[model samples]
Target: MVELRETRIQTRQRVQPDDTNNYGSAHGGMVMLWMDEAAAMSAIRFTGEWCVTAHVDGIDFRAPVPSGDTLYLDAYVYDAGRTSCKVRLRAYHEDPKTGSRTETTDSTFVFVAVDDNREPMPVTTLECSSEESEQLRAEAFAAFEE
Candidate 1:
């Protein structure tokens, strides 16, 4: 009974002096923040109400994003439950001059809808209407674990 939607966002921030550690690289938490923001947007779009981060399944930092790179984030709600929506997020690091991109991290976050009284609310059903959407559905199902 939960409606699901998909959304995406992109960000590029230099590993500024404040955004990095002594190693001159972005912190894992900072990257997660971006991912969370993007995923939350998708959840909200799907539910049309305030949503809360019920859980973060996990985050995998597959590659390192250096100081001067741009971080790109893509997030979408690919699946839904009665009151919960499952979202997939992917982060990439891009070189400005070379226009090269590398995937840095990817994760799935689950969000719950909250009404004005902060009670759990049901979301609408999700529809996959295109080849791209079907592909996303397959990928989501493949990633789903029992």
Candidate 2:
């Protein structure tokens, strides 16, 4: 079994001019790309196998990340099935100077563990040993239900 916290992944990317849209904010596509990469890392950590994205749940952009801000991405495996892992991903915009952060986007993604031959493989069960991990799992499920 893999503990939920063991699969948690966090990454930061500086928003560059080329990564922004005409509105001078981070492009939705660019943000989604980062989210996918972070989620894949989390799934691989949990499953100990190469995983491919199976589906992305609805992604909602709550705020814009300006070009000068740093994008903070967090991903973790909140649930798992025989072959698939569901990851909860969130992005936040942080001001480099004051270190203030605001949530920019959130979504969920599903990934399937695959073998060397690219065939789907069973994944070990996910466990939540800490109270924080258990709360995170419950929150993830609640968000999915909404």
Candidate 3:
């Protein structure tokens, strides 16, 4: 049994000059790409199977990540169905010199577990350890229903 906390994932990448747009901010597409990858990893950790990006929504770009910042992505499986996992993702950018981080984006993604043939496969449920986690899990599920 995989605990919900076990599915949590965090990744960081330097925002290089090439990763930015003409405005010197990280490209929206680049951020989304990194979020997708991080979310898939969380889903895979939960299901122990290959996962593919199925859907993404509510991608709010709250702030812009400058070219010299370090982009940080955090993801976790908040809920799951028979074959799909719902992941919550958030992005932050840190000033390398100042070591201060600020949230830049947040979104939700659905990933479907897949077999070797890329066919949808069944997944196990996420287990929550503490009452706080259980409450959070319920809230996350409710948000997804809306």
Q: Highest lDDT among the candidates is held by which one?
A: 2
Give lDDT tens digits, candidate 2, residues 9-109.
99998999999999998999999999999999999999999999999999889999999889999899999999999999999998988878999877899
In model 3, state the lDDT of residue 81.
Answer: 88
Better of 1 and 3 by TM-score: 3
Clashing pairs in 2: none
Clashes of 2: 0
Ranking by lDDT: 2, 3, 1
lDDT of each: 0.78, 0.94, 0.88
Model 2 misplacement above 4 A: none
> Across residues 18-115, which tens digit of lDDT does each residue of candidate 1 receive?
76667877788888887888889888888778999999977888887777777787777888889888888878888878878898876789999999
How far is 124's C-alpha from truth in model 3 (Å)? 0.4
The C-alpha TM-scores of every prediction are 0.88, 0.97, 0.91
Q: Would you give me the overall lDDT of model 2?
A: 0.94
Error of 2 at 118 (Å): 1.0
